[model samples]
Target chain A: MVEVGAHATAEPLVGASDWDGGALPYRVGHKKLGMWLFIMSDSLTFGALLIAYSYARISSVAWPRPFPFFPSIVFSSVMTLCLLSSSLTMVMAVSAAKKRDKKRARKWIFATMFFGAAFVILHMIEWGHLIGDGLMAFELPEEWLKIWPGASPLFGATFFGITGLHMFHVFSGLCYLGIIALFIKRFDDEDVEISGLYWHFVDLVWMFVFPLIYLLSIKPS
Target chain B: MEHQSKETKFFNMTLLLLAGGAVLVAAWDVAVSRFRGGTDDLFFVLVALLVALLFATPPILFGIRTGWFHEKFVIDDEPPATEAAAEAHAEAHGVEGESHGVSNRLFILVWIALLGLTGLEVLLGYVQLRNDLMLTILMGASIIKAALIMAYFMHLRFERMSLVLTVVPAIVVCLCLMLILFPDSFRLFHLR
Candidate 1:
């Protein structure tokens, strides 16, 4: 009891001063950390799908030639371009938000969502054409009889599995972007930046997927 | 904080250029395929890499030339006291202080190297290089690009080392899982 009152008074001052001066923008919060953790888990999910695809590819006799079975490169290329452009727009939206230009931020975010929607629509069209040609996950191809004539079901299974999963992600990401854009009008700068992180991450994942699924497997028909 | 608006123009210009380049590349790819044989997977990969490089290059270069690369988002240590109080109330834990002196020239150089390696990948495809060698080269380019984006654009290089330490281990573990699981699947198919 000799000096306890004095020490208690001193402690509050130190704590208050520390609280007043030290804070950062783009700081990690519970929500941000949770989102990052979710992204990490999602990365693992994609990793598993990619591993499965690789295993099926390595073990299959007479792997299906992706060039012929898939739609023309031109169509997929356009879709890829759309997605990439969306990434750029997303960065711009983030930059705008950081400047506290909510109006511009909303515009750029809408642009990003638009591009994302275009990508999903194009993918849907491609899937429709492919399904019409007797291609689906786990479905054995009739063309295998005419082409390789000795191909295994693993070829089609892995192809559709990996690409279809990626497509599902693309669709979900579009929806996410759409919702984020809608909220842009009300969100503070920090919140907008947080949403931008997720949007950019989605774009980044697609950047890897475009090459792996669509580009890496293409050989001469 | 004050520098944000000044940099916005540069960022917007870069975005426009990237969008334009993407459209051009898509059109060119389509046009080239009509006259020659259709684009293959390898070719498409090269094109995509090229587009990424093209999109990433201008901001890095312009920032370097204009000396804006050294600018940081957090311009001042003492923000409005009220905002600071509110931030503290929220208990947002982020890196304090501004990031400065990020080397834009170095980043651009890295982009160039990435693009050059992509070109080499395309050349290798035409020169009939072995598949393994070609893949190795292409993947190497991809790694370099990823490193540049993470270290520079994402500012991981300047941030807390702990963040990098945490994220990298997860990525490596994911890669290992891929390596292990893929071969097993291949063996089951009897292709391996």
Candidate 2:
């Protein structure tokens, strides 16, 4: 039985040790894998924030649904479209890089950055509308309580906290793509793919943020 | 060259079959709602179908990139059997395999699907379901979209299965652990 156990363990030990000596045990590039690890940790960070926001929301007597359909919801939906388009453009850029079409890849990368910037600008405009309505980080607008009595002050806090973090990620993704696009000639295809991973992840997070934050809170007509 | 063992092949095929079924169901749902002629029914159907598609498309695309569906189209011109040899071959060649590399068309479809899903989410918002139900549906749709982006656009599907196993489970386990705190919120709600 001891010999049997030793034989069973020996196979996996050999397999496990393959990654120890500079070999790509996962058959993935070190940089790409490293980025993936970063993304995983970042996902947890966002996940925790989202969970905390949800907790505050459910526990509160009332959460403000300040976004009306006309400007807020429509604007955010357009923003979602913009981010999705950027992800498509990012894919184009990655595929172009893989094909060694540097010029075309650079063009696509710029296109992605353009869309990402558009999303940020649109988001800023949305924030402008909210702040103009007196929605501060810690204070819900006085009018909001008229619509939703007992509205939680935490609404503004969580909304800004979550969406602000997402917007920062979008802004950072734009800058990251800009740097990659500028240095397209120097960076290899994997770098482009890695950047694309980050870009897509930004879009991925919006998938949750848009619905939970915007759609869920659409003011009843 | 690495060969897919019979069990792995079977598992992949099973995943493909389920994805195909999901697509068919989504199409059917849309058609049924169209025939019903209620605008609200249409919105409900579209939202429901989007939910199904969110779960469906990734597996099919994963299969395509892994060359499970179109294996016959793969040009397996062999030179040697080492991993380095494969890497060098891929370097010399543009892509590892033409059929195995996910097509640009597939990504566009995914993009459109995402947009359609978002549109449906908005439409569902207007439908005025119960608050709990609406939140549940929205959360479900968002998760599906995230999964689609991660699987296709991020190329997690093309990566080694072990990487997917590692990254996905870690996130899932962490999320599950966090779920234990949910009851605390309810207690707070009652206290208020």
Candidate 3:
């Protein structure tokens, strides 16, 4: 950590009550709170996208029905499981760090990172299959006479746009986890726990996306 | 100490039951798929319901296993001086000291209720329910699951009520804005 005076920065008032084992006043710090506020704002961005999606769905004449062709549940199911398990490992990592079990914390962090990687891989495969089927991000596959007779471009556009944005977030989160895991030794217990909080937030977001983007779209077929 | 051990056992049993529920649902899917060839859509709905239930089970289980659900940050039972000291320490540090003994049995019951909701949704889908009805049921389930997670796993239930209050308004406003604004935009675009 940088020395408090090296940068000649303004510091909070130092009083006898503020001294607590050489830690900050709160168990949480300003930096962590700032990150959370940023996340909350970003969540609004997603909420807007989803709202736009719902609007598009409501206004469109034909939606090509959202299930069966899209989501490909088997692939998504695996990915969802991977992300969920990563959350469990992340919580375990935080628990270990809180107990000051450095080795266990590192192991759990690595495990969480591994699961994150697996989730990204599965997502890539799902996207590849969709693209291979000619479902372009902005363009839809031509309506087949027999198969997918009612398929429309809007389906591809909305599906890709929503899931693609989510994928971007997932990839970014994976990178974040990987970077943190690399410096696991450097983080204090509190810092490690804060990292875990971010990881859990990512997982929590996916919990919503998995159902909304994948499972809810499943039509009877 | 014995009570703690018993609680632990109860929690473990709850996890096992949830896992067993998932396995049973999966087995049912396999069996029905093999014997009944024409009910593919029904089967898919059943499987989807099971998956949603399975996804929701873990967070509740985590809260139970971690003893977070019933954990109290303020110790009302302690002597006033000790309590005051702890409260002062907590306030100074902006931390809420919590009791570690959470009731696992309560979590298990919550999980079971969630699973039941999932089952209800699947049954509704099977009975040729209206799309709006089915959607509302599923969304309701999602809301319940989200609430369980935020309250239990995230420990929002144990946190300062002010912090909790601060979050809900933001969520509600965002949701309302998205739901209302998008449709209006689409309607305007259609006119163009």
Candidate 4:
């Protein structure tokens, strides 16, 4: 391995954080840097999944509409509302941490946890309803199978794959937030901030997911 | 222990998580198929649920003992030197020492806007406009909402340019990936 002491001083690359004993750019905390990078890559993951899902929709002749008209949109809208509300609570948690008000931060984190968990539960219920409608990730319902006998299996695969992956994120985010809640007294604003970043990203991804998955697919009555 | 932003290190969970997720999806597919296919075996569903429970445990354990992300990234928990670094960071962002620097009322307002946008989108979904136009409108509304959350809720506005630059490539790469979908659209139109 080349020793860094060889040059003792060379121009530091861009985006190098001072925390890593380097220089220039990335002056933020490790959590912030890590969280930011994670969000960036995570966003790309969702982007790729969404693009693939749309591609499948386009490539297929006729896709199944198992989500059931506008009611599914309404349910998902409420789910979106829960997540948006959780974001506010998450900000409140960070803001409270900034004030050194651990109690308020704890309260807000608890509230955020409640809201995030609520979204997941609502989401699971929505998924169950869709499943009850005879949708499976790898196979179409017997009804759909009869009509579009040659429809691409990708429709179901991408639907479940993309949405399932997002649901996993939501679940992991909730667990992360819950863990943060358990130790709110020892945490700081930056901790709350990073947690908020992850939570908001989940919300942000859902913002697009809601429109693309539910709204765009609404088959008019 | 200041870390460089240019460093190519990561706490990579992508492959592991993807593998786990794909397994869960397979389990889900199996469970659904068995249920629908008349097997009545709930083993796959149980496995899927077990995976979720297993994933939930790590973060809780991470909380108990500060994990790699916290051990490396959190600055304030360090010595006075890092505390000074934190202060310098706050000053650089013009957010030094004002607890809850952003307006709570404004945040609530943004939340309201998000809620209202959700309502509007849901309503618009009911309108049977031309397909492309409807998708465009819905997409536009969602993008606006995402921006609101990112700028205000996630505090990206207060972050530095370096952090902002990180996201630029993600978006650009996302747009580039859309090319993969282009060739198939013709088949979509003609094949049906």
On lDDT, the candidate that comes out on top is 2
TM-score of each: 0.62, 0.74, 0.62, 0.69
lDDT of 1 at B14: 70
> Which residue segments of model 2 deviate by more than 4 Å?
A1-22, B1-95, B98-100
Between candidates 2 and 4, the TM-score winner: 2
Q: Where is model 3 chain A poorest over a 10-residue stretch in terms of lDDT? A: A1-10
DockQ of 3: 0.07
Q: Considering every candidate listed, which one attains the maximal TM-score? A: 2
Classify candidate 2 by CAPRI docking class: acceptable
Error of 4 at B27 (Å): 51
TM-score of chain B of each: 0.44, 0.50, 0.43, 0.47
Model 3 spans > 4 angstroms off: A1-27, A69-71, A144-152, B1-128, B182-192
lDDT of each: 0.56, 0.77, 0.58, 0.70
Off by over 4 Å in 1: A1-27, A68-71, A219-221, B1-129, B148-158, B181-192
lDDT of 4 by residue, B75-165 (tens): 4554335443344344444434446345577677788888898899888877768877988798889889988888778876565444554
Scanning candidate 2 chain B in windows of ten residues, the lowest lDDT window is B91-100
Please give, for residues A76-168, the per-residue lDDT of candidate 3 as tens digits. 766766765676677667667767778888898899888988988888888887687677755665643134454445767777777778778
**Candidate 4 lDDT tens digits, A65-145:** 545554576678788888888899989888888888888888998998898888888878888877886777777878776
Clashing pairs in 1: A55-B186, A59-B191
Task: Give DockQ for candidates 1 onward, in order.
Answer: 0.09, 0.26, 0.07, 0.23
- Per lDDT, what order, best first? 2, 4, 3, 1
